[model samples]
Target: MFKLGSKSDADILKSISPSMKVLSSREAKLILRVMDECIHQIEIVSFFPSLLENPEPFTKSLGENLLRTLKEHQELEERHKCLVLDGSHDQTNSQVALSAKAVQDSFRKIVRILRGTAEALRSKETQCAEDIVKMRDGLCELREIVLERLLTSPGEEKQLREMVLEVSQSHAANQVLIDSLEKDLAMAVKDKDEEQLRSTLQQKEKALQEFVGRTQQDAEKQTHSDQKTSEGKRARLQQEASQLNSQINNLIAANREAEVELRKKKYKEETEIENVIQKYDVEMGEKQTELEEMIKMHETDQTELRELEELYDVLDVEYSQIMEERQKAQELKELQEKELEIQSKAATVIQALWRGFCTRKALKSSAKSKKAKKGKGKKKK
Candidate 1:
């Protein structure tokens, strides 16, 4: 509901998020064809966390693509993490292996997640939505800049917001290219990464500076144009629509001319798809030959999840016991410390009383000796 950026989080979630997938007849067939590949890719993608840690084997774009795939895969895994097995689907036998059907039943949600993720990857609107996050980061920097310059005017602040948005705008991701000329860094001493990265930064900096230089001129033009009346805007829109309609007509005519060619292309594609399906059927059948009953994958993950939960419970109980023991030990130490303090105080008081008694005895003995000496002197007199 909050309108901080172009798309609110709730709206973006609604737009990009996939609903729960049911196993439709067409999708079920498609799943059977690609079931083996799905399992293989899922297992391989499990190691993607490591690839994400070290994406040196691929380009930045490929790395990002891999990350998106892994996230969908993780979501797919989440659907299978239930305590009870979902064996609700009727045992309908089809050309697809029984095992594949089982997997489909357990993971009916996979196709939707993958389709949604793939669609998001392809769409520019999704990318623009992602830029909102980058813009939010830029907003933090803007705040810091404003706080640094306490005397910023309203006009300056508006310009700063525009500047931040411009900076935060997504640029092309082509920083890393395999350089055959440069020696392998693994073999040689590693130079500064910034030194290698500086070229890309410099290019982007130059582009940003040029854009900033042109913006004021462009703004002045836009300001003048924005003064146009509603009638003028409607006229301009009508003219643009007319030009677009003519372009569409030309495209339609060209498409009609290519109809026969398109049919041929479609036939070829169908042949290729059938061939691939035959190959995949053989491969998938062999791999899933042992798997007859459905939800083996789900059961395996469920078992693992249960084991982990049990382990966590055991660890938690042990931790609680240790904490209890530690508390008892601490209480005992405090009790001993209090006892030692009481003993020390008692010893101090006893020593003070003993010292006072010794002083009094010495004083009384000195006074008696003085009195006896005075008596002897008086008798002599």
Candidate 2:
């Protein structure tokens, strides 16, 4: 609802919704990731109403959601810290508290903004939003700076300078917080002193009461002990020792009987175990014999298989030779058929030429005979 970065980012924020049904870890995680990327980019400063007359309009619920997202971020950060601190690290593993604390900030301004948004509504909202926006912008810039440093690792001198700047910024922030806390603590000095004094008095009184009770109990016991005699206590102790000796003798007898029983049981168990072992050994021997028989059978089968393979190979070679002979015969038969066809065609051509020659000769003879007959008739006339 805060105009985050782009229209697309805003749409994505709107799209994610909490369900009425209980959400699984996966869904919750997805929602959290989306909120981080989208909400982190929210332009809250520009949306400050008192500051921006034509502010980028946002819903109150949307603003609340923004605060909720920031809270989630803080919680996630705390969890990360816990995980880091409580992780199962080996002896060699260590952390660089100086560099980490120096570079990364505690995000005080953002947290203050969230607190303001939660309780003090409008009066502090503008300032809170401004601070939050500035922090976010600063974070982004810091990320970019780190990214650039990572991309091209500078010389020691340049790196030192950058690191010093970051460290100074964090130190200044921490100093300010310390100063503010000091002021608050100063204001509560009287109450704190009174509370400390009251707590001290109560502790001392309780201790004194416990001491008096112990002393009174001891005094009463001593007075009662004064009335009693040492001889009676000695007699009681002797009686107790006698009873203890009797109990020890009885326990020794019972232990001896138990030991005898345990030995008997152990002997029986050993006998049974031996019998079982012997039975298993017989079965194992029988199985070993069976396995040997199977192995022999397998060897016999292998010999037979080899013989069959040899026979197959011989038959295959003979079959190959027969196929080759058949192929050659078939080729010869095709050649003979071709030769026969060519001879038949040659005979037909020779017969057609001879028949043409004979017909021409007969026609010429008839024509000459007719001409002679015509000449004789004309001479007679």
Candidate 3:
């Protein structure tokens, strides 16, 4: 809309928007140019004749508001810088200062409410750092206790006693914090310094120190007492172990004596067992003699049985040979019957042939005589 052909105050302000969203020098230059053009347009509208008057007093009122808003923005920037300085640490001072400068520059374009909110965030960051410091100290104390327990609670009860002394020293240190806090509170109220709001904070710190001191003392006393008890118990256990060792030696001696008696008893039982075994061996020898006689009888019976088996084998061979001869005789009988049947068939065939030839010759002679008679009759006629 702010093309060169129709450049106007409103169009320039509209163009200034995108530049305002950016926080670079270029945006700042564009904003300055827009402000100048708006002021020029105000002058032209108020005094010049051709352009219609802006009866709403837009340019003058907007310029005044912008100026006021910019002043408020700058004030917020200063307040944020002060808060950051109050909270800055040796570790974060340089980097935080640089960041605060950038934030101040950007705040020039921001509205007052947003700048106030940023200040609140910085205050919260300050409180967070303070709380982190307190928590770190508390954890350090806890770690001391844990390390003392783990590293010191062995072999040397005197070391544990010294740790209890250190704990008392730390408690005295807490009393020092309480004294310092009381002095700070007294000075803060007497000086009428509203901004020195550390009294309540100091009170809280003092109270935390008191609580930590009491708890640490209680833990120290308990641990020292436990260490003493453990020492006593260790001594008792050593005494008990010595007594057990003595008892074990006496018991070992008694066991050796009992073992000697057991050995004598076992030797006596072994001699008695040897006598019984000799008797059983004599009985076994007599039984063995009887068994040998029975075995001789069994050998004779077995020889007779083997001879019977041989006789049966011979009989089986002779029976098989006779059955073979009988089979040959049956086969010869079949051959003879077949030869008789063939001879009878040949004799019957020869007799049938002779009978047929005689009958045929007689028939031929009779037919020839008849023929001769017929021929003689014809000749006589």
Q: What C-alpha lDDT values do all the predictions have?
A: 0.60, 0.64, 0.63
Candidates' TM-scores?
Answer: 0.26, 0.33, 0.28
lDDT of 3 by residue, 1-381 (tens): 112223455654443233223234565456555554443333322221111123133234334554454455456666666766665444466766676776666443433323323323323212224444555555555544433333332344454355456556766777788789989999978787655556777888999999999999999999999999999999999999999999999999999999999999999999999999999999999999999999999999999999999999999999999999999999999999999888888878877887888888889999999999999999999
Clashes of each: 0, 0, 0
Residue pairs in candidate 3 whose N, alpha carbon or C atoms collide under 3 angstroms: none
Better of 1 and 2 by TM-score: 2
Name the TM-score of candidate 2: 0.33
Candidate rank order under TM-score: 2, 3, 1
Better of 1 and 2 by lDDT: 2
Winner by lDDT: 2
Candidate 1: global Cα-lDDT? 0.60
Instruction: Please provide, for model 2 over 1-381, each residue's C-alpha lDDT reduced to its tens digit, 9 standing for 90 to 100.
Output: 122222354443333322223333565546545544444444433333332232223235336555554455455566556546775653222344532442244343444454444333333445445567677777666655433333332354364465556557766777788899889998799788999999999999999999999999999998888758676888899999999999999999999999999999999999999999999999999999999999999999999999999999999999999999999999999999899899888888888878887888899999999999999999999
Model 3 — which ten-residue stretch has the worst lDDT?
A: 46-55
Greater-TM-score candidate between 2 and 3: 2
Q: In model 3, which runs have C-alpha deviations exceeding 4 angstroms?
A: 1-256, 275-294, 365-381
Local lDDT at 234 for model 1? 92
Segments of candidate 2 deviating more than 4 angstroms: 1-265, 349-381
Model 2 weakest 10-residue run by lDDT: 49-58
